[model samples]
Target: MNPMIRSTRLALAALLLTALAGCGDKTSPQTASSRAPSLSTVVVKPETAHREQVWDGVVEAVNEVTLTAQTNARVLELPYDVGDTVAKGDVLVRFTDIEQKSVRRAAQAQIASAQANFRNAEAQYKRIAEVFSKGLVARSDLDQARMQRDAAQAALHAARAQYSEAGQQVDYTVIRAPYAGIITHRYVHVGEAVQAGPPSPQPLIGLESLKDLRVTVQVPQSAVDAIRNHHHAEIMLGDGKRLAASKVIVFPYADPKTHTFNVRLLLDGSHASLYPGMTVKVAFAVGAAQRLLVPVAALWHQGEMTGVYVVQGDSVRLMQVRVGERFGSRVEVVSGLAPNQHVATDPAAAARYLSSERAEPKA
Candidate 1:
């Protein structure tokens, strides 16, 4: 009749039962919440499929140049400044032309002197020839006249060449836009000296055509083949607007440092927002085939894993999916998915709608 011993034995038995129950339902809090739907569901279906790869792109001018002085001269007149739009052959900047002008003038004077001397020599040569034919003058005198005439002709040719070269030097003083474009930057100010050569010492201005635009991407080695082999591409603007690429160019060589190939996507026409140096996205269709698709909003991420919530009959299953290219609002499922499955649009909200118990079957 040990009453205290009997009470202690009952408490130990209850404790053991509780421990066993807890061990059987070993689920983490995060896992438990993820298994249930917090919101509504979406049904996914097979779509006319295309695989897309998005790459970071930067907008660039189709025709861009850094304007620099062609000769060593002081900047005299800079008619255009930063942001000024200019037409082809429109004078952009002017350097000092005093020396060039002087050279031109001197050459012109020399040409005039040569012409006058040539006129006198021609008249003397004609007179001397007549005298020689008549035997009234020595043969030596006629030869002397002929030599002077030839010398005058040579001098005239030299003077003309010098003048032509001087004229070119004068033209170099005035800088003009080669094509219609906007001046993005002005590197040289008034009175600044600039040198011109193969390696320009300083850039005078930055000119870029706003009307014609393109985007450049350093595509990784993986995507280069698909893009180079006649795949479709589109430029995605920051506001979510998509424009089909008019031209696609893949650089023949990959950069040694980055090991990525350069790709240029030429846009169709002038866009107000698309300009040089602006960041954008480019989508390339790497492959094409029929595949299941669901709205991008349906996808959820947990660390490195991406998944979606799916409804299977009376029960909901949180699934892991392998995804490919983004097609507007929807994304393609490469694996871990089957056609005609119900997918939740928002996994977080959908989780709140489901419980540990299976959903009831509908009529």
Candidate 2:
């Protein structure tokens, strides 16, 4: 081969090798610090954190019942509807009481007859006893009079009981509130036929006492001891407001199936719309100690895994974290984060950076 031709071929191969090496260096993945992307950061300031175990719970009424019909009757009158507040003994529903009233009147008449017979028997027995003692009447006559008086007294007693029962029947016709409560639902209107108990004639009304409210939390058995010994606790509303629990009632036994104990916490009476069935959060005091805190927005959620981007001197790394009870906009770092470290405030931006870094070409 010619010397000039061989030299040209070698020179061309060297240039191609150089270009490939340069391209590889340009496309290779690099650390975040190498790019030095500008990012908003938050300085971690550890505060006196309250360590609590938060459990999702629901607001419940202290007294709630679906008032049922006591006797099969057509609803004669419905005085209240849903959302009506009623006091104890307030008539909520009135049924036709014609039969009950008639029975009561008959019982009253029987009482009247029994009383008259009893009086006559008493007077006769007294007269016979006196005469018998004076030897003016035979002993058999006295015995007969005594038996008649006793029979009259027994009749009177029966009559009284029948009358009382009849009165109750009449009273049952008028359904009244057992306690002061707000009517949440009314299942019957006037003229609706309501059946008697057991297969309780479709509930007449649903009543609940909201003034006396409580939170029932089914706590895991593992946290039973903590709840039992809970020195202090607070309930967090959906809006992030915290209110202290008036009392805590930890049930002694745990459910066999779920292995959870019922923990009842009473709420302070409020006129607000903190209604029953609202989902709330309960934070039972496990312990009180200082810990790192971060804004909830700073925490990145990756499926089930949660993390935060810790930025140190322009170098950012995704750090896994365990978050505890939320405090306003911030949350307690249970672990994986330290005090005085800066983290990206915008988790979305941090996540984007992480994604980009991952998308870089691999050697």
Candidate 3:
């Protein structure tokens, strides 16, 4: 092993290491340049807007009445069924009144008999008084005659009162509608007996006016204050039509179980298609506060997270957001967003732009 020969071998080894390092650097640059550039995207300018709160509700008739029987009797006939339209004073039901009629007739006969007895007693009393005045009868006899006449008059008056009471009982057999409306329910059927007074099962006949419809909504305790203060809201139908409502009446009491207040809205006009118990979506404008809003196309929803893409300096950045009320084709951004920011309308193109930016090397 000569010294000069060993030194030459070391030099060659160092030269080989330098050549390998140069080759590695050259391969890295080529690999980076081979990646594609990111694509461009369209941007949308989001605006600051106010959002409304929507609540679910049900439609009902403003005027509703329940009919009940006043006396206990077998139902003889029911002229109308459920869903039947009835006018005021229309006969809705009829009970068997034959026995009542017979009682009335008996009362009338008693009145007549009493009246005849009163006439006879009156004539006898007058004749006796005349005799007494002419000295033909004593004072005691005249007094007895007068007493008989007074008793007959009292009997006649009692009989008359009995007849009137019997007549009223007979009238109760026929049930009539109190107002013009459609019959929503019929609790009694033919031959069904109904009892009067409390604790007795009473018949229920439901009536409602379809001309005026109303909606009742339950507002959460959190939103009750808003409803009480503003009293302005909007109703959205299934078909996407919105009705503006400025009148909202809040029930003073809140439900103990739900802790929500009941609110009723009077519809402006009669909605023919609307029926009682129909579910609807209601939106109430509690306060006018500005927030950020964007179109639905600009939003991207993933599992448990919602976000949008904003174009910034030739690249797109993903932004998480909290959504609020929806106004037609637009939605309110409750948080994680700012006004006047340019968001990418197309999410796919925006993603491509982001990926390309990451792939590019520093200038």
Candidate 4:
């Protein structure tokens, strides 16, 4: 063979060997066929016996009363404003009582006049009766004197009753707090005329007792039965404070539109800072049976729904699950999941890796 030809062949052979080595290096350990993707998992198991359902609610006063004006008059004075604490029987507001005072004064005058007339008539009647008894007066005359005396006495009693009524009407003009509470609202200011009777009588003030707080929660109709029988509840304040309530009261009927029932949880008196209109979360211990649950990380939220990836053999299967109440770190799985199922902690990475592995041709 020619030496040039032999050199060319050697170069060609060396190039071929190098290409084979590079191919082997690329396909050896890091190839999809050789390496299986690693995935993190969270084991599912039956939750502990203790479980509770948490619901959102708002804090409310135990006793809330709306104070309205009792007499139609211009607001003369408002000693208390919103957020002012007052005691029972405390005069919170006052209306113009000039007319009531005048009426009372007139009644007093009438009573005095009637009393004087009664005394004079009684003295005249006594004299007349004495003369009649001594046979110095006719029977008709005595009868007329007795009638006058009776009429005067009746007039005096009527006047006294009218005076007492007027005094009570005057007292009603001053708006007093029905109970010890904090004034939450004041609608009337000086010179505002308020109607006394109902139908449209604007409440002059709003009062709420702050010593004891309550939470009103709207529970679904399905859970209404459980709440009715429930004896205790837990309340979570807006500030992250947790409290246990001793009693739970459920409304007898469900709302027609929402199909939900109103439930109230009474907080212990120690939680004085909780006031009306504060938002809160309430938890009721409705059921005690055990159920399967997993860490929130194991579940994936997609759009409006949630799902989890179950590890089966070497592949992960997507599962749609219905979730129930969340109990701390773990959430209850109401359906579509079984106990002891291995759920992928990171579903996004697991799915991608699984897809890559399946795409490669098998050996």
**CA lDDT of each candidate?**
0.78, 0.80, 0.75, 0.77
Q: Against the true structure, candidate 3 has what lDDT? A: 0.75
How many angstroms is residue 316 displaced in model 2 relative to the true structure, after the best TM-score fit?
A: 32
- Mind giving the per-residue lDDT tens digits that candidate 1 earns over 1-363? 498987776667545333322311324212232333444677777776556788898998988998767677899888987888899999888899888899999999999999999999999999999989999999999999999999999999999999999999899898889899899999988998788765645688889988899888999998889887755788876655568888888899999999999988878864787878898878887887687878888987654456787765544556768897566777778897887888878776645544333243322
lDDT of 3 by residue, 276-328 (tens): 87898888877777656677778776544577776554334566678876666
Q: What is the lDDT of residue 339 in candidate 3?
A: 61
Residues 1-363, candidate 4, lDDT per residue (tens digit)?
899987787677555433322312323221233453477877788865544677888888878988877777898989988989999999998888999999999999999999999999999999999999899989999999999999999999999999999998799788888889899888889999888777766778989987777788998988777766656687765454457786788988889999988998877658865778887778787877788887766776654456777775444556668887555556778897888888878868765765575577767
How far does residue 129 in candidate 1 sit from its true spot (Å)?
2.5
**Reference-based TM-score of each model:** 0.63, 0.63, 0.57, 0.61
How many pairs of residues in model 2 come into backbone collision? 0
List clashing residue pairs in candidate 4. Answer: none
What residue runs in model 4 are displaced by over 4 Å at the alpha carbon? 1-50, 135-139, 197-202, 238-241, 289-363
Backbone N/Cα/C clashes per model: 13, 0, 0, 0
Candidates' RMSD to native: 13.3, 14.9, 17.7, 16.5
Candidate with the larger TM-score of 1 and 3: 1
